[model samples]
Target chain A: MLKFNPRNYLKVTNGAVLLRAEIEKKMDEVSKKEFKNLFLIGSGGSIAIMYPFEYIWNSTSSIPAYAEIASEFMLQSHKQFDENSVVILSSLSGTTEETVEAAQYCKERGATTIGLVGEMDTPLANIVDYPIANYAENDYAADSINLQMYMIIFRLMHNNGEFAQYEQFVSELEKMPENLISVKEQTEEKAKEFADKYKDEDYHMLIGSGTAWGRTYAYSMCVLEEMQWIRTKSVHAAEFFHGTIELVERDTSIILLKGEDATRPLAERVERFAEKYTDKLTIFDTQDYTLDGISPEFRQYFPPLVLGSLLQRVSVHLENKRNHSLDKRRYYRTVAY
Target chain B: MLKFNPRNYLKVTNGAVLLRAEIEKKMDEVSKKEFKNLFLIGSGGSIAIMYPFEYIWNSTSSIPAYAEIASEFMLQSHKQFDENSVVILSSLSGTTEETVEAAQYCKERGATTIGLVGEMDTPLANIVDYPIANYAENDYAADSINLQMYMIIFRLMHNNGEFAQYEQFVSELEKMPENLISVKEQTEEKAKEFADKYKDEDYHMLIGSGTAWGRTYAYSMCVLEEMQWIRTKSVHAAEFFHGTIELVERDTSIILLKGEDATRPLAERVERFAEKYTDKLTIFDTQDYTLDGISPEFRQYFPPLVLGSLLQRVSVHLENKRNHSLDKRRYYRTVAY
Candidate 1:
């Protein structure tokens, strides 16, 4: 609760939900057009946000979806990408050099582009065919961008007749602002306890599987390393048994983000192994919290969202306890590289 | 050159090149059959080896290529995977649990599976439709497996009219055993110097781009973490600037795996930043080694293979200087989870 702003959180979340009409119109328009595949392109957190949707599309839709890093995507001639491809891009600042360049690249290739940005009338928003603008500070950008992505991605799938429960899912998504507040309230104590315990910890191995893998990666890189300056390794749970398991010891901190997806068993295997090997195992399972409006079947798709809100609490506590400003940076924007 | 066996290395590398005819026969047969997409599936180092090939396919061929983690691949219901798909799997041991299971899963789904294994009659080799077996010891497994993959993948692409230089490439492949010996001879001192300097270092950040990314990840996880019990963060060169750049101090060991590809600029960007930020930066560039029999046009495709041969030298030197056995593992197969 260090920087919690209930009014702003509601404004951002509800603002995304309110975009249901506009997002739907765009989805309908794109769905009506002929496209071969979906290219979800971005940089850093924006690219990480696309991974889950790519997974979902791969698992559920006949349409091929690729989550590509923007900088590399431009240079690497993806044989599957063409004029018939629909690309989705995001950047909170609307001026992430690579994302903007990627959008321009796609536009030049006659590909349809959609961009999500924090502010309008900027490079990224202006370059894309369809631009969705939502205002949120750095702390809540994930929540805002993720909510908008859920609408854009699922609506597209629904329009394609791949996801039938679109209306029902939106109805439930409307309750997330309130439900997420409860999730934060429930997780605050655990978050505080984890921060107090691990404030001085230098390294951690964060693991997750399936859709949860993206959050695990983004948190380790973007949040922990970038924001908190913590050294962390984010490995998929299924891949943990391969090489990373050798690095585990009794004191090695293992943070597991467990989700209720089909790949849950993979994470469970890591849980079993870590429970036996490391005494400092901490799990943030979405199943631990009760959402008032979310149904059991629908919960599988909500882990990333639930964990996004929950991890924000952990980040705030870490910032408060470690006496490190979350916004402080040594080189990100301070000096010329 | 510690533990370097020229005869065995030649035996393994040439043995794989000799499989060119059999590999082509199998690829021709598979190409005659209709397939929609290509799935290169494995776990850890096995999976890491597929990334560069996936990049190759995306850059050069008209097929949609996905390199997936085997354990999670089996759990996630991938809509793009079906009877009409072709799957390429590899396991140096031929008994990697998740890979064998994935082959079985693919076989049950009626997909065409081609497996590359170290030995014949193993679970993975036995389960796939086409099993290409080559003899290789633990140290030379990457060399053997990579050589075989080049044959199988390029042959398939050639059969599909995607690659016109298959025969020319094969002629160049025949000289790799001798050429790689030279690569090792040239890298010996540099690798030894790296080992001598970093023997006591606890952590490093490995960066790479394009075809070198897979080797970067594998060297960090499989060699350093699993084998030497050292800690490392392997990040793509493009992603390095996004988050990991902040962790750079004057003494941070930055291992840059520079390759000749379009994404070379991305790695060069990291090189520039690391040069400015960290004094302990070590770059292993493929351009430094003159491969005698390889043509300039074919150099881009050889980085992963070149890096594989070069990194083995680094691994051997580290094993000696650090007084740590490269075969040592705390939990990989030492005990049950």
Candidate 2:
């Protein structure tokens, strides 16, 4: 009777939505400044959410944008910072040690720091100069606010549509919460099916390429690694083509994230690759027109974001099916220097 | 009948050795400032071989290093370079479009460049400012030469170390060619044992961590993917604790590169992990008692390069068993921005 209950995760997901909306409003209202660059600090899911924003922002602004998993930069060279730099710090529970240390380092070096999180009362929220609360209270994979906040940031970035139309998109986002609930249900059902079949799989390899490739990085390290205690590895699909693809044979259950963007073709290729080995290929296509003409907002960003949320639910569900409790001790552990 | 032949690979291996020796001598003569940072660039095996050198150099001198496959970097950010960088480009065939473009990009940007290759007159060798020929005419995994050149570079990094001891190591290296012939026989036998059990495996997962992790990265990408055309994935062992390890099943094959280094202990942990799912596990330990007694070259600088060569040999032998020809082409279509 190991049914997956995402009650704890749901509350944080709700909080993250609120926090992200607030931060987007704040960033938008601020006086526009001519700046040389934008720097972001957050690793794992927190930073990954920034990718869509970075991609959108880089297209519009002349300012150069750079980011590193806060822990990764700390390992190598240390660059001096100043007040003019715009720095964003994000964490779901708001307690990742690396994010906190990076925040402190940036603050000490006089960088204008903005913190985003699902938790309102955590030390990270208290210490950061500009704290935007996603309002999450507990630590659970289902409660991850990374995507919720990321969607808001991406929506805001779309405000300056160098790529496509935005008015309809913004209006659609206003209705996303209700629409998202339905998507979540479908995702949960699919996850349940997957968990039933693959629950005993002791090692999992999640592979994707391009922007989604980084998704593998975080999922392997954060979700599958942290929550499930499963042996997992994520790699870019093209890199996968380099040598590892040779090991693919029947019996390898692979999950491929089919990004609806330019990376869609690569996903398709990987799906074909998996077929060569076995039929146990899970290909997530974000463009299924099942809802066909759904709200304008739901159509644009909801595809991948909805899929991502579902994948999160699936991972947790799989963990539950295995009869393992979610462990968040590492989440609370002091971010190692 | 299509049979895997080592004759072509052997010729390339010889060429790689001479090419590596030339690069070694050239590096010794190059001005220190010109060699500011050792930028190792290539795809697959070339990139894999340089990991040990990067690890070793970073061991002593705080001289910074960056190692990346040319194709991956070219797809995204290319602005991380400046005029003062020293680019060390490696390609077994003196082809590989990405390395060629990277070398060209470096030359155009006023960076001193060096080429390590299997052929003297190949396009890659012609494009670089200093091209060192390994004399490896055939591009089939530049086996012996890859390690030989790496050892020379490792020695060069320790030029400031005790010369008397360095000379002794050189004497040992002179003996290494013969040593490798024996090691080749040993690894060949081991590869046969592994292939007998797992060559028909539909899925294989290889795991390593930290410095040694690069070999797994390279092997999974180059040897396993390119040569075997099998679905393979490599992962950091530390990350296994996070989540993906759950994919391991009674059917999946797991290979652990249990080298005798700090990360060796990590192999045992991974072994325990593999046992949780199935008893199908293999550990390859570089039982180098002599390596321990030798003057400690920085792990970062030495291990990957040394281990890379050894691993390349193993991979080539495995490819031989898999009945795949190692004729490399299609270098990810690299073009300069």
Candidate 3:
């Protein structure tokens, strides 16, 4: 039997912080004129690494940025490159064929390639101009490293001319490493309560609207399906009214990520939806922060990048509710083509 | 009392032929330019319209082309545009916020904009330099116009320059409109079978992979949810093997869009999946095709586009199966939005 480590959240959160700091330290050395675009490439959990960074980028500098499934960037037509473009290639295993190929393609196209990896030495690290190494001593699939790398990039941009005005946001982000751990620890009782109450259900639905849309979409549909062997789907709250609410029954479970801004109207609607199915709705919201301050800019978006760590924690506890373990790699083959 | 006239597949086939001819005529004029990249933008069904064109472009030409959801495109940075680019904007309404915004953005960035629309009088038609209008005399939403416009575009590209090699393919497409009609007549039985067999089930899953992936993803996940008031989820067949198959049970309903080509292996897997449930599977294959020489270039990709019409047929039939007359509109609501 696996022993439950009480510090799971702290370890993961700290790892993310250190990872971010290390990446930013190195990025401080690179000249601003070197690259224009930052292509954050990954898939599955590896892709989640860039979400916070993407938010930071969109919030601070209008510097063009995009994230693609590594395979898509490599296989699709991506001629939008100059020597001045920076390609941040991330893969926890330092393998992920698509990310590897994307890194190679960027280098071939004369773009500056930056490697974010869990291992000190790998094909990805060897190919890129700069490699940020994370030993990934923890078995959390390098989420910490991914988070750290994104933070580093974000902080570097913020500290530099790109996002000088956004220094406060970076500082706020800096505070999250500790807050995330605290939140995860504090939320365990609530999560356990949620899992115990609704664990027997066969299906899970996650709903969100704006910015949180991608995260909820990724977590409920992709991550839960990939990690927990859960049959899950997500929808925009407004869209939920369009049709999906009919699928809600007393036995069905709905996880609503209300975040900050766009919560009230959707919350009221979901309250009615929950009443119809009585005792089937679960909401994850940042308690202390109102819609105004916590997510001042894209407040209507989901907040899991900061608070979603709690969901990640709750998901692990809810594994017993699933048909398999939390880390079931059934869908992924060891030998990637 | 409403009098029912049997749909003449032959006339429908002829209309498909005319639509293809018109789109092809336009493609002949457009393909002369040397473009390094092509981006097709649309939302919902309009994005579905680009399926066949992307298939033809991928198979016949060396140039890179792709169709992306307009909403996703809007979130990304677009400082990487100048000339030698082609952007095809598709939206029947001409006012889909995302598409309209993208059209304006693409135009501002110097990418040539071509509008494919149902209404010649709409803003999208007036905004673009070259607009191909497929006016739907009666229909409000994009039912016939979408298919007609795509067929025209594919045929024109097929006839242009080095594309002449696929002339036989174009001829087969010319015959597809008739095939679509015939298939619709045939699906009357299958749709009834689907409705009777699976209507009581609480969930529905639509599975496809590769080129067909997007269509199945959009239709079962997006359209069926919008139209049928059903709980449907779309899964890439490969991903199904990853973890989704565990959700299957004796009562579960699965719709497999088995397009021609590499889909067979996955289809066979799904067949076994259906058998495990003792016959709860409804599979749609290329028997829906009327034309034989429908170019096997991107065989894995093209079949789903062909199935677009087939899905519509099934949807209507499923309504009859449920003893519900299809409601075209909600009270006092305009379809224009």
**The best candidate in terms of lDDT:** 1
TM-score per model over all chains: 0.99, 0.65, 0.73
Docking quality category of candidate 3 according to DockQ thresholds: incorrect
lDDT of 2 by residue, A1-337 (tens): 1333445444555545544456556666432433334677666566655554454344344344555446434443333235656677777667877688888877776766677766577767776767776554443332344444444445445543332544454444444444455555667767788889888875555776544554656666666666675655466665555554544557666778755444445567677767766667776555653443355334534444555655666766876788776664332232321
Off by over 4 Å in 1: none
Worst 10 residues of 3 chain B by lDDT: B328-337
Give RMSD to native, each candidate. Answer: 1.0, 8.0, 6.1
Model 2's DockQ?
A: 0.18
Weakest lDDT window of 10 consecutive positions for candidate 2 chain A: A328-337
lDDT of 1 by residue, A153-252 (tens): 8998898888999999988988988888889999999999999999999999999988898899989998899989999888889778778888998999
- Candidate topping TM-score: 1
Q: Residue A85, candidate 1: how far off, in angstroms?
A: 0.3
lDDT of 3 by residue, A245-329 (tens): 5556676788877655433355456656665564677777664443323335533332645455567667766775454576566
* iRMSD, model 1, in Å: 0.9
lDDT tens per residue, model 2, B1-337:
1232445544544444444455556766654544545577765667766665554454444344566556544544444455766778877677777689878877888887878766679988999877775554443344544555554555455553413345455544443344444444556666666766776775677887545777777777666666666566576665454334545567768877755454455567788767666678877665552343334542333345345545655656566676665653222222111
